[model samples]
Target: MASIKQREDGVWRARYRDEVGKEHARHFALRRDAQRWLDEVAAAVVTGQYVDPKAGRITWDEWTREWMERQSWAMGTHEAAAVAVQSVPWREGQISSVKSSHVQAWVAGESKRGLAASTIKTRLNYIQMSFRAAVADRVIATNPALGVKAPRSRRAEAAMRILTAEEVREALDAADEFRGFVEVCVFAGLRLGEAAGLQLRDVNFLGRSITVARQVQGSTIKAARIVAPKYESERTVYVPDELMTSLAAHVTRAQVTAPDEQLFVTPLGRLWNRNNAAGEWRRVRKDARLPDEVTLHTLRHTFASNLIAQGCDVVTVQRALGHSTPSITLNVYSHLWPSAEDKTRSATASFMGEIRDSADSVRTETEKPQVRGSRYR
Candidate 1:
């Protein structure tokens, strides 16, 4: 229900009862202005787009706090989300008022602050998600950040490195005490943290399978917490007999008999964290004389690339890498699928060749040897 009335004070008042019967009102200088406001409100209600005027009054800071509490995030994702939301430029203002211009300005500000393009893009994604949720909750009519563009991250793409067969061997030999750790990453495609969280129980030596159940979620030994794999990508990766034998030898060498004991650990038997793992990786890279651009994660890329080289399909590569979806696998490693264009040409040539062969075989005898052949003569 809605109404527009002129009071004795010469003010035009517009009033409406919302879907829940809560009343809202505003006073305007002109009767036409009050009527126009009522019409807009009625349209919004009929279109199922009605948002209570006061609902958007909550600030971005307050909304994000409530939103974060309701999300079920892994430890690492929660930390990243915390950092991302806190980094937004206008936390104190009403979230509904944030416009696309504000989001663009924030992107520009992040660039000026010397943040990496990828980092700025990630932060922008979080801001977009927040506004999208706000729109869904009826706290805002639209997502202001939906159309905002983020700066492109070119450096990371340019630096992607895939190793060859010999390079993989050299890197493994140079890994020294970390050989088994590097092997699992290169052969099984485990992320650094996933390999760190690997336990004896997760390995099926006879079956040559390793189950990815959890990951170490922090950089420091003291702060490290075991959590489910990223994006719930818990899965089993099958290994070659050679790699399985290597893991068996590693167990014997490390004397890790207990099923719960971590297969890969520091000399102090502590779980490997990124910081410590990076230091060792540097030594391995330098000793192996590999390109400086090759990081530990590159080994996982190499594994994926090798799978593509072996003619594995997208789902096979995605499952091997524990990617949440085949689209993500393609997004990251589509270049490695060498058969896309090749298969097109080959398929066309194969069918055309069959047509040509059929025509040649069925040709009339008159078209065959006109020269002196015994049968033709």
Candidate 2:
């Protein structure tokens, strides 16, 4: 039974037992207001949607740290999120009090700070994921980030540059020690981490395929550790015979002592990370006469572009790039897929020619019947 009593100050105090039989009291100026609050509390308890008001008092930074600790994200993902969190003032604010407008404003601020669109998207993802965790814990009703947009400004719309075959040849020629590494990237579309983590056992020399099963990821290049391929990108990708030959020569020169040894590494066998061959990569790009903006990752986009120009299917490209979904692959490289303008003309011509042939055959049959005096007549 609910209880309503007039206090010494003449305010009405309503007392009620919640679902767990915990007593809670709230004061109101009028008896009816207290009664209304009690009724709403009863309804909420019956609906199993009741939330403790104090549960969401924790700051966003605390909750995000808790949630991040519970997640088994890769080291690179963790590092990226940490970098974004450092700049977020909302991390110190209450998680429940954050509104959609606040998130939108924050995204706009990040864009104005000259952060790239991709980096801003990563920050937004961190925010969205934290809010989603709060929702799962019943600390908040919804995720504010769901309604927010990480604006992609004009500066973020640079067109992707694909290297020509001559440029690829020149880069490989100047690559010197890193030639095999560059070849694998341009020829097989292997990500830097994936290429760095490749072991001798994962390659099938006779089959001419490299199985991507692991990758290097950590806070620092020298301190990196091996983990499973990103986004479940573990799959087999075939390389050309010439690339296979190059790989073989590189491995032989490396003097690999163990079949399980990593294929590419320093002369002393210190495992390679993205930074290990930076000097070699710079020299290769410069000697090839490529622009300063051309990074080693540029080979990945070039690989996809070349495959698409050669009429590779979307699903195949998605698999090759280890994209989580075909839509992701399409979103980045959809334009590369052949529009087949030449094929469109050929298709129309073939259909019209078939119709003409059918009409001619019918007309000849009708004319022969009348011209030769039909056998039936």
Candidate 3:
């Protein structure tokens, strides 16, 4: 049941008892507005479908913490997810009350703050997913993120910064100090965490492959405990003969100090930090006179792009990258397909030609043969 009352200040209020026996009230400036709200509330109550707005009243911070608590992944990734979630524009306000306009404004602000498009897109997606979950849980009537627009992402073709073969050699040559880790990243395409967590036992010299089954995290070397790979699936990546020789030479030079020593470690025998790797890459890039935008991960991209450009199939690349699906590989590297434009043009021209030929044959057959033969018979 709902009713409208005019206050002494001439403001109208719509007060109602929802189907759940919860009281809700809203202030309106006009009588018509109050009446409209009252009518809607009454209808919802009568239909036994009234949902309490308070149920949706959670802050972005609160909901993200809940999500972090419930996630069932490796601790390293869970911590990463939590960090990403916390980086959003969280404030002491109801998550459901966040409108599409608010999200659009936030995105604009983030762009002005110079955050990368990829990072902003990722955060926006996480918030959108959080709202979606809220909607599914009946905590909100509708997801405010349903039609919200994210910042325009850079096109893959435009954003790709794959290093050339000569540039790769130069960068690798400059990174001779961390050559083992760099070699693994370049040849095996292992992620930074995977490379940091590599142990001697994980390498099978006889099998000519390395197993990617763990990752490392945190600042302290003592905190660098092993966790499963990103997808929780153990897989092996083959190493090239030249890279194998490099690995063997690197191991002999480093000299194993512990029974279970990590394959790539700092001079102090600590796990490598991605930031440190990136810093080393910056120095190496300067030494090689490469462009400023190039980083260590460019090596991985270069490897994948080279394979794709050389006619390696999507399935092979997917396995090498430890991707769960061929579609994932294709979506990321489809821009590397150099002949896409030419192939599209050729296909379109062939299709049109076929249509033209069929039309001409139909016209000739229809116009020529029918009349005289029937009259003679």
True-vs-predicted CA distance for residue 155, candidate 3, Å: 2.2
Clashing pairs in 2: none
- For candidate 3, lDDT tens digit of each residue in 1-377? 67888999999988987656678899999999988987876675576544577876888788777866776767766656666666656456777787877777887888899988887877777778777777766677677767776678788889889887788788778887787887788788888888888888888777789898788765455566677777734688987788778887877898854636888877666678666667766888898899998877777888788778767889888988888999998889987876778779989999999999999999998889555556655
Q: Write the per-residue lDDT of candidate 2 for residues 1-377, one digit (tens) a residue.
A: 57899999999999987556778889999999998998887776677556666668889888888888998887888887777766677777788788999888888898889887877988888888888878878787667889687876333125677888898999988988778789888999988888888898887889999999998875355678898988769999987898888888988987765778888875566766767666567878888899987887889889988888888899999998999899999889876765579679878999999999999999998878444666896
User: Which residues of candidate 1, in runs, are more than 4 Å off?
Assistant: 5-9, 111-121, 153-159, 165-170, 286-292, 344-377
lDDT, candidates in the order shown: 0.88, 0.82, 0.78
Runs off by more than 4 Å, candidate 3 = 1-20, 23-35, 42-49, 76-80, 88-90, 218-224, 257-259, 338-377
TM-score of each: 0.80, 0.80, 0.79
Give residue 21's error in model 2 in angstroms. Answer: 3.3
176-261: candidate 1 lDDT, tens digit per residue: 88999999999999999999999999999999999999899887888887888888589999999999999999999999999988
Please say which candidate is ahead in TM-score: 2 or 3: 2
Superposed by TM-score, candidate 2 places the C-alpha of residue 66 at a distance from the truth, in angstroms, of: 1.9
Q: What is the overall TM-score of model 3 with all chains considered together? A: 0.79
